[model samples]
Target: MDGSKVALVLATSAGGVGRHVRSVADGLRERGAKVVVLGPASADELFGFTESGARFVPVEIADRPHPLGDVRAVARIRRLTRDADVVHAHGLRAGGLAALARLRTAPAPLRLGPAAPPLVVTLHNASIAGGLTGAAYATLERVVARGAAEVLAVSPDLEERMRALGARSVGLALVPAPATPPSPDLAPSHEPESSQDARPSQGTAAPSRAAAVPPEDHAAAKRIRAELGAGDAPLILTVARLADQKGLPTLLDAAAGWARLDPPALVVIAGDGPLEAGLRDRIAEENLPVRLLGHRTDVPALLAAADVAVLPSIWEGQPLIVQEVLRAGRPLVATRVGGVPVMVGDAALLVPPGDAGELERAVRRVLEDRALADRLASAAVERASRLPTEDDAVDQLLSVYDRVMRTVF
Candidate 1:
């Protein structure tokens, strides 16, 4: 009811994190709460946090661990959040550092005396690394679990991990995708079942029809298919970064099997990252029927052009692209990991993560049966209709803040 200041902190964010922070910042300011976003200057440049009416303070929170730089970052975080009623940090790196700052720094000349403001941390991803890197991240997880007043996870697995690590308050984070704009041609066909009920069926195809698309979209799809060298071949599209976490290797392995199919299916990947060079080399050496498109902007058109949409990620936490695929009303074949099953419901073909055979078979199943593909496309549109919006994310976050303040402050 009274004036209270909140500090939202994060590390490097090229995509989802930045957009989410900006959206949350806008929502908080609209509710009359004083909001300040503290992160890298580059993140501000990319995401435009200040444009959302929140004061943007440039704090260098690097992606990896560095001794001297981390000290400097902690000092900055301490100085910036000294007057804050609550501090909320996103991602493991930022959360660990925020926890360290509050633990080390003395109480400042602000609202609370002798004790720093309560800290809240949100975990958006899981530890997919191994050996030294995995251990380091695990250490950070424990630091966050013990230091934070409240912790939020974007998936069930993350939530369970945080609780096991002894976090006082661990709840699911509300990281919702924006609802897709409705099409006049599409209507509510049937309610999709939960992930438990949804399974990739090998049964005979059910009678179904493709979703209605505009002539222009179909034309654009045709153009893209031509560009990807899918003359008369069935086009299979995957939109992901060329990184290990994205499971690009598995995708290539699956593509190897597709070469034997009649007319030979074409695999087109649209994204760029560090693993590009090696991936290209392997593709050339193996003569796989796959093309690396390297980050295309016309994703909707690509989705339209495709026989099927695919995501072969090793792990993900409510990926925006999967939601985008659903919005486009495309039949998806994705790995079952993180929040993917929860997101897709019965809308898409979900397979085990990093299983190339399963991934290949799923794509094959979709391509072989036009009726089953149409059913998935119909369920996708239905799923897109039920996804939460930016407003829902803000409302959920506000409740978390309120509870943490009342319980800890």
Candidate 2:
């Protein structure tokens, strides 16, 4: 977009959404597009949108809906996006607020007033709530569907839902991969069945790094293992914020089952959030073999140090951790939910979202079966090579903006 003015709106983002918006701002600014990011002041403080070279404006669009707050946010968004060529909103609540501002009325109460600058909304995650909360979110989905000129979805399920809700145009949004680190080395396994071949096979796209692990990574992995008090036992790693959506209870349940294994696996969860205290209580109460390593910055080392990685999210939208795991070339066992199956293909063993037994089985296979682990690790590297880049995301985003502009103008 040569000098096109684009306003990016999002809610109070703390994790992937915040990083993604910042990445978009950086990419758009580098391409000479005038980008303005509007979100909570805390998000700017966390993600540094202004540091990414985009003009940062604070408009409090919250994760949860509030009557007075929504009104204030709608007014702020409407005023800020008035001069832009296009307005792109991320997440459900932020998109709904932007849509209300752009349409000038609740479409159910009255007809759409005007689509002045053309609105585009990106649906990043699916609703996991039920009953009244789910219904409220569904209503917002319809509002966004009816208001946006075009909608971009992060997963197939999200795209299908938007289309069914009557979105004008719906397409898959490409989440760019996280920065790649040096591929991890296979951990020494004490299990009789494990310790088989764990290297890339003959392939054109296979990672060209040597069989030897990077020295610094090796040292870091050793340090992390010792610090965690994991001696000869294998390390089972999960890198997720301790939240309901992450299905931590199921992970703990699986950990309970694995606790009986001789030289039982040490489960390490390396992120923190609202559910930290609850998860900590469950671990102590059940005496589960799981440790919470709250809000870590050394994920690459954690991946390198682990025997196998697991993700048991109830729903996810192209999670950056999965991409990072693939780049690390670690064997993964993730739930077959949302974008995960498409992301991992045959690179990971897929289990149902809440099935602790199946999850335990899949993870155990990677621990006990050496050949499977090697194949998954090799396949992960091949998959990593094909994931979308930041340039690809910007090119696709510009295409959407261009098309929407042409239609609106």
Tens digits of per-residue lDDT, candidate 1, 1-409, equal 1367889999987677777788788888887789999999999999888765679999998877777888898888988998898899999999988988886542331233345778999898887889987888898898888888899988889988999988898988877654445432233324533322222222333112235243435445545766766766777889887877899999999999888777688899989988999999999999999889988767777777777889999899888888888878888999889989999999999999889999999998887887788889989999988888888888887887888778753
Screening candidate 1 with a backbone cut-off below 3 angstroms (N, C-alpha, C), the clashing residue pairs are 271-295
Top of the candidates by lDDT: 2
TM-score for all models, in order of appearance: 0.88, 0.91
| Candidate 2 local Cα displacement, residue 176, angstroms | 1.7
lDDT of 1 at 373: 87
Error of 1 at 166 (Å): 0.7
Tell me the TM-score of model 2. 0.91
Candidate 1, residue 394: the lDDT equals 81
lDDT of 1 at 17: 76
Residue 1 in model 2: lDDT: 82
Each candidate's lDDT (Cα)? 0.80, 0.83
